[model samples]
Target: MPSLDPEEGDAIRQALGLDRAARPYRNHYPAPGDDPVAGRLVERGLMERGAATPAGLVLFQVTEAGARQVGARLPEAEAGR
Candidate 1:
């Protein structure tokens, strides 16, 4: 099982929850710089950052493995997709 530091784990959890309207993550969580945890997640294919929008927001998406790591029971809308 892959492990993460508390902060990294928190980020992953929030991403998987997929509640941006209520939570508004970008303004709150600063982007990682040379982040080892983020790198590890990428290396393991657990998460991916999409191209930045014109507004400079980089969309983050969690892979199935990442959701499983956080024990997220994805709803039908999000399941197996």
Candidate 2:
């Protein structure tokens, strides 16, 4: 995978809500036109695209690897492993 630059890292953090608190597992639904970095994130395997909304907007969720990249704690089960 490609290394994350400052912009990409910041984007991942924002998507995971790490910018606010430490919400590592929260899902983010960016505005339809606000997904330039999102595609790159998905390509990097840090985030995955979820189901589409009624209006056709896609849901984006952080993966375990993505959470770790941002220094966010994994769930108990995954963490224990």
Candidate 3:
């Protein structure tokens, strides 16, 4: 399997279909398969990992770069929501 990389952040962002302004939703969640993508975003400085609660809930938030990336690729997958 291919690993998620900075080069692919845009693809992942497009897959997320997140709105720029309303992004970084407090309760925003990523699918199981998006872990690798999230890692890639982190590596690219496009996303950051938020503190996990004691309940084991993992938190992640997108950065400005992530938002721009998603916007750039919006036409690709028709904005993956």
Candidate 4:
């Protein structure tokens, strides 16, 4: 796969619960607000949209490929796998 652009990389990181000082959360999926980069990632088959929340937020999850990309950037200990 081609390397991601910086914005794309950041989006994937955020979705994987690795951004923001690596503070893990129960809900790892993130709902980005009208981000073109996130849309591009969906188009590229790296990220996928999940069911909407009661508040109408569309959550985005990383695909296996997306996780692999982020995993490559993470240290083994930090990668948690």
Local distance difference test, candidate 3: 0.50
lDDT of each: 0.56, 0.68, 0.50, 0.67
lDDT of 2 at 45: 85
> By lDDT, is 2 or 4 better?
2
Indicate the residue-level lDDT of 27 in model 4. Answer: 22
- TM-score-superior candidate, 2 or 3: 2
lDDT of 1 by residue, 11-80 (tens): 6767654344332223122245345656566677776655455655555556667666766544455444
Off by over 4 Å in 1: 18-37, 78-81
lDDT of 3 by residue, 3-67 (tens): 44554654445434443533333323343434776676667776667667566655555555555
> Where does candidate 3 clash, by residue pair?
none
Question: Which rank order by lDDT, best down to worst?
Answer: 2, 4, 1, 3
**Per-candidate total of colliding backbone pairs:** 0, 0, 0, 0
lDDT of 2 by residue, 25-63 (tens): 454645453587777778888877777778877777667
| Rank list by TM-score | 4, 2, 1, 3
**Is candidate 1 or 4 superior in lDDT?**
4
